[model samples]
Target: MSILREARLSDLPAIETLVKAAYGHYVDRIGTIPGPMRDIDDHRYARHIEAGHVSLLFDNADGEESVDAGNGDKPVGLLVLIPQTDTLLLDNVAVAPSAQGRGFGKALMQAAEARARQLEFDSITLYTQELMHENLAIYRRYGYVETHRAEEFGLKRVYLRKSLA
Candidate 1:
């Protein structure tokens, strides 16, 4: 079974590692076109965890009979969600490099949406670098529509939103 929970202070290191590993390639893959990806730093993530903006999702191999590969207690994936006045912003989503292509990102996002509704938020929002085509497509499939575009932190970012109301 997969579980979603609020990230605790202790999970900072793991979360940082996961985020960096998850997004570190974007800068290299896209070159300087989209500029840079900001969520790929360890200390940056530590700060997020300290500020209580991170959420964790763990997929226990044992709980999923179909997943024969065991990961012991390590988190296979994580989602960073920030709460706002009218929307829940998904700051980042990452799955372990060894565990990609298994729908972990999507499942984690679904949990985020549920949490947003529970918090009485009217919408969900996130921004992705133009270079991250796969991520943009995934968000689109999940009902997020492009809302804006900007260049932030040296990267061309496309913002997306989905109304829950």
Candidate 2:
């Protein structure tokens, strides 16, 4: 079974490591450290975690089945969700590359949507680097429609939104 919970201050280091391992390969594909890694180093996640906007997904809660290939205690995926005036923003959703294809990413997406409803938001918004076609396909498959494309934060980004109501 997989477990999802809010991230605590103590989880910062693990989240940083997991995020780097998850998005690190993009450096070659996009030519530069991904935004998340840079943000990690800047202690951005520290503020997010403190604000309760981060959630971690862990596999193998039962100690019998390890979703992270036996490293059950380690988080396999994470989601950073922040509430906006009328939309819930999906700041980031990352799954350990090694843990891909095991549904952890899907679980985190579901969590984001669930949180949107909990916050009484009718829509969720997110963005990804334009070169991350893999993420674009996944987000489209999950019903996020492209809202626009623009350069933001030094990265060409594709913005998307999903409406729940």
Candidate 3:
């Protein structure tokens, strides 16, 4: 079972560790550590947690497929959302490598859209590295359309957006 809920400040260490475990493998394929690995630190994670934008999707193996999972949530997924006037920016979405193929990532995406709708945003926007073909395809499959491409932090980025209405 998987549980999704807002992240607490105390989850900083777990968040940092999970982000690394989630994105570390990309360092070899992309020739650099992805932005999420470098960015998920105490300061940044704390800032987002305080703003109520960081959510965690925990796996409760002992539970019987429950959404809340009570208090037995374990390591799994992390999502970061930054609200803009017109759209919710998905700052980061990472799932622990060990937890892949378990639908945790998909759950996080659904959570992001629900949060965006709750905040009254019309759409969601996000960006991924140009070299991350798998992620791009998944985003497209989930209804995100490429808006443009740009370079930031010396890396080529493909920006995409999805309308909620």
Candidate 4:
């Protein structure tokens, strides 16, 4: 089972670590990290959490039907879903390095889609750096169609959206 919940102030530290770990390598490859990663002074994560825009998802280890032993309520992944004026934006999704190969990202995205549907959102959108081919492919596989392209924060990026209605 998986548990998805709104983020709390206490969750910021862990969330920051998760985000940095997930994107650090990509930053090195891009030659310049985006502001979210670069200018995040201590005040930022807490501010975002307070704004209620971020969310955390945990895998219920005890609920997994595996032969191996199970754990409980351990934070395995996270994502920030931002509600724009007209569209739902998937800001960021990061699975712990140890949890990368699992389907956590897909599960998180599915949850995001379900949320959009419940809110009557017409579309869901996101932006990914052009060099992040792996993420671009993942979004493409899940029906996100590219609508625009640009260079932002010194990295080429593609904007994608999925029409929900």
Q: Estimate every model's Cα lDDT from 0 to 1.
A: 0.74, 0.88, 0.86, 0.77
Candidate 4 at residue 117, lDDT?
81
Q: What RMSD, rounded to one decimal, does every model reach?
A: 4.1, 3.0, 2.7, 4.2
Cα lDDT tens digits for candidate 4, 1-165: 777777777666667777777787886777788545653564666776788877787777668533211222446777677788898888777788888888998998898888778777999999888888998999999999999999865768899999988
User: Residue 121 of model 3: what lDDT?
Assistant: 93
Candidate 2 residue-wise lDDT, 1-165, digit = tens: 887878888788789889899999899998878888888878999999999999888886576542331332688899999898989999989998889998888889998999899889999999999999999999999999999999867788899999999
- Return the lDDT, model 4, position 132: 86
TM-score: which is higher, 1 or 4?
4
Q: What is the TM-score of each candidate against the true structure?
A: 0.83, 0.92, 0.90, 0.86
Q: Please list the residue runs of candidate 1 whose C-alpha ends up more than 4 Å from where it truly belongs after superposition.
A: 32-42, 63-72
Best by TM-score: 2
Question: In candidate 2, what residue range of length 10 has the lowest lDDT sum?
Answer: 63-72
Where does model 4 exceed 4 Å of error?
34-36, 63-74
Q: RMSD to the native, candidate 3? A: 2.7
lDDT of 4 at 142: 97
- For model 1, residues 10-116, the per-residue Cα lDDT tens digits are 67666666666676677577675332135433356667677777777777656753321133356778777788787998887778887888878878888888878
What lDDT tens digits, residue by residue, belong to model 3 across residues 1-165?
A: 677878887777788888888888888888987888767643688888899988888776678665342354455998999998889999999998888997888999999999999999999999999999999999999999999999888778899999999
Inter-residue clash pairs, candidate 2:
none
> Which run of 10 residues does model 4 get worst, by summed lDDT?
65-74
Candidate 3 local Cα displacement, residue 10, angstroms: 1.1
